[model samples]
Target: VGHTIESTVLALESIAATDNIAKNLGIEAGETIYYVKRIRYIDGKILCLEESYYRQSIVPYLNREIVEQSIFEYLETALQLNIGFSDMYMHVGKLSAESARHLGLTEGDPGLTIETVFHLTNGRPFDYSVITYHYEHSQFVVQANGLYL
Candidate 1:
């Protein structure tokens, strides 16, 4: 949580077809969607690989420049969309061949998987993502804070 890092875009484009299960939530089948993927690194060491799909119709102004920088920035500012809430689910998994390749690990290596769902201000699901964390290198801790009146 306190490290300088760099990001690299692995792929970013609009796809008319998607296999994402969240499509059924609102987006129509065969509808266009923005598929964004990137790798996060600290001092050149890969930390995680994140891949997300956004409903194009909901965030249609996205461009390559925005993708290379920050999609959330564009989503919140340029698009003027509010992120109502999000849900995260985490689990341990065996790294898939593709995920392993992206993280520079051998197949069958340990991986931490997290799936996230984001809802917009209108209460419509707008984004869904799957992130793979390098189990050997990742250090994640959650803290709890409560405010009382």
Candidate 2:
């Protein structure tokens, strides 16, 4: 599980870096800059979330639009690893509270338990489902269901 989580993080970082470089080369909106804040692993899977930010002082020479898009494409492809939104949201929520107060979420926030499953189509929000899992004397313990919040 640790390896899986690390792989996901590295993949995301690589995509973001690639986009940044492409932007410097005038590629366009193929990539967007994001700061990874958290990663969580459970039941042989990993989840992560990142926040996007802009740096005006460090402008790239490439086409920002193309570079941003390219980055998005890269992430979307990597997500094919079968990662889920529930894990991402929970981990990110915790991370935001711990390391990104600017994100406006706090630890033990009830909202984290709600909205367990999220669906995406073409990188857009589609719908969501609730799920729960528990690991007893095992390596994972996660449990939730629809609309707890």
Winning candidate number (TM-score): 1
lDDT of 1 at 105: 97
What digit string (tens of lDDT, one per residue) describes model 1 on residues 64-132?
677766677778888889989777899897988999999999999999999988898778888888889
Worst 10 residues of 1 by lDDT: 16-25
TM-scores for candidates 1 onward, in order: 0.83, 0.19
Off by over 4 Å in 1: 17-19, 22-25, 144-149
lDDT of 1 at 32: 81
Which ranges of candidate 2 are over 4 A from the true structure?
1-70, 74-96, 99-102, 113-149
Reference-based lDDT, residue 95, model 2? 35
Per-residue accuracy of model 2 over 50-141 as CA lDDT, tens digit each: 22322212222223332333333443464342233432333212332542232233444322322232223323221222211111212445
lDDT of the structure predicted as candidate 2: 0.31
Provide the overall lDDT of each model, using Cα atoms, as 2-decimal numbers.
0.80, 0.31
